[model samples]
Target: MPRTAATPEQRAHIREQIRRAAVEVYDEKGMEGTSARAIAVKAGVSVGTLYSYYANLPELMRSLWAEPVAEEMVRLRATVEATPDPLRALRALLEGYANFAFDNPDILRGALLFVGRVQDTALAPAPAAVEFDQMLRDAILAGQKTGQIKPGPAAQIAHQLWAGVHGALALPINIESLDFGSPKQIVAEMIVTLMASVKA
Candidate 1:
């Protein structure tokens, strides 16, 4: 039988336990291979208990996946917001992006695979994708307005930059040879090249 939602403290305990067990299973078997029954057993709960909290496997996986990305996004947004200089802000954003991917390589790979599979199937953007694209657009506009970047359509520039970064990151995961350099080194070079295109 499923465990019912409990008091706040009980809820916290259950959620934390589930998260740890989920990560372990995911790490060992990858997201697709990790099953609710296995996760429940690891968490000392019934599969029904897992369903009580999460509607399905994808829902649970999405929640788990969002945690790290959401945290990184918050940190990146705060860093960008706090920086007064446009060029420095862009650099910080790129640095944060690279660090997030490098530090959480497994999660990053899972997310990329999931995103690639689901992206065009829906017309509406996923929450993370929308927020990420918006952040890039905002940064580009800010740079242009501050005269740190040359005048151009902000949307066009944002798309170009996003495409460049996505392709760079994706290649490393897809092709072994391309994974040779540290992501930081590659991102730094990409940032420099991107910035040069926009310099006033």
Candidate 2:
């Protein structure tokens, strides 16, 4: 007799298993070295089974980040919204992002930082990422309105701040031999410097 198909819960469980296995494989070997077969082996599932859930390795890799990014955005939105002072809110958002990245280095390197070898626009910024950018833009606009932040395009300022903070957090992780000092301290100092530069 033929076996019954997997239930919705079973499918979700299998998808998560595949995603976790992908993260491990991704950690062991960078994106260029990873393959469906390798992930399937790590997941203890057939290559065909892995393909059923994810269209390709990049898709699986993208899945690894989906939840973490969304969750982080939610937390940031809450933190920004709660702080009344716009300048304080912007500082809080930046610091909160640093803390999250430090806390989840695996996810950071494996998903957030890793741009796949292929140049696919489908892999463009997620909705959560867009939301994150909007959050920064909004915070900057508020601060500028209050004359706490320097006058400039809020979106550009937001992008610059994000780029600076991300570079600081990513450098130590990407280069193990470099004695970059504590990531937390580096990020804190970087945030202060960036904020000060943009101060009115």
Candidate 3:
């Protein structure tokens, strides 16, 4: 039976505890092997309790991983927002992107895998993706208006830049022996190349 909580504070605490336990289990078991019963035992709750908070295993995992991804996205958006200059803003964005992936490789990998699998089937996007798209689009449009970026459709330029940045980061991370000097260095170079491509 699920533990009954008398207060909102207690319920919130139990929910956090369950989430923490789920993250630990995910670390060991990966998503496929992790189960609600397993998470319940680790969390000291009933499987039904887990279900009460999260409708299903996928939803739970989504919430679990979304925390880190959302955090990184916030940092990325803030970094971009802090610098009004187009070029400097782009550099800061690139660095934040590289740093997050480097610092949280496990979370990054899990997110990438989950996103790849469910992206086609899932109609609703996690909030981070939406924020990222908006920010990047705005940035590109701003750059074009400032004459820092070459004349092109802001939408196409934003899409290309976004894809390029991820490809630049994703490549060396996936291939250990690919031998980029460092993730930051490669990302910096990639940013330069991308900036040049877009520069007026």
Candidate 4:
């Protein structure tokens, strides 16, 4: 069971198991309440074995959040790339962004733990976050090129799209009582209204 000799698939599977355990423990017990021992027991591995896979709990936490986000980024990119229609791709990207949150609530919540605890990387860009940002920019660029999008700075439009969907996500969390309708529906209309302003 030499770690160095483990196949990529083997390593990925083990890492996934560790991450799932960490996520469950983290959700039930706040980050401070979670420990290497708890994660190890939950994962059915020895504490020493867990450390062999991850240097510490914090590292595991980062991986738990980062890995899923990266995977979702791949999904989002594929979904966008598959659609040739610019407007359709834009819609796909927006829904994909919201779906990222919906699909991985635990990992996202676990990541919030690092906000203040690890200042350097906490606020820093995760690779998946970066990729998602790129997809938004790419989608905007594609729309602009096809004349489906209004003429405006691609980056600005991308940022606006990002912020708008992000707001959609936040409203549901912060004000659960208010019926926002479906996030996608609200965002789809936002997309149309925004695109109208920028259309050539």
* Rank order (by lDDT, best first): 2, 3, 1, 4
TM-score of each: 0.67, 0.82, 0.71, 0.63
Q: Give the least accurate 10-residue stretch of model 1, judged by summed lDDT.
A: 114-123
What pairs collide in candidate 2?
none
Measured with C-alpha atoms, the lDDT of residue 96 in candidate 4 is: 75
For candidate 3, write residues 1-200 as lDDT tens digits: 99665598888998899999988888888756677888899999998988788766666777877878888887887788789997778667656766777787776666654432233334366687777777767777788889887887877887788777788877876677867777777777888898888888
Q: What local lDDT score does residue 24 receive in model 3, on the 0 to 100 scale?
A: 88
Tell me the deviation in Å of residue 149 in model 4: 1.4
Residue 131 of candidate 3: its Cα lDDT? Answer: 78
Model 4 CA deviation exceeding 4 Å by range? 1-25, 30-60, 111-114, 119-123, 176-198
Top candidate (lDDT)? 2
Q: In terms of lDDT, which candidate is stronger, 1 or 2?
A: 2
When 1 and 2 are scored with TM-score, the better candidate is: 2
Worst 10 residues of 4 by lDDT: 112-121
Ranking by TM-score: 2, 3, 1, 4
Per-residue lDDT of candidate 1, residues 1-200 (tens digit): 99675999987789778878887888887756688888899999888878777666655666777867888888888998899787787767766776777787776676644442232233344477677777777887788888888788877887777777666676766787644587667766887787788778
Mind sharing the TM-score for model 2? 0.82
lDDT of 4 by residue, 152-171 (tens): 78788878877877766666
- Model 2, residue 37: C-alpha shift (Å): 4.0
Better of 1 and 3 by lDDT: 3
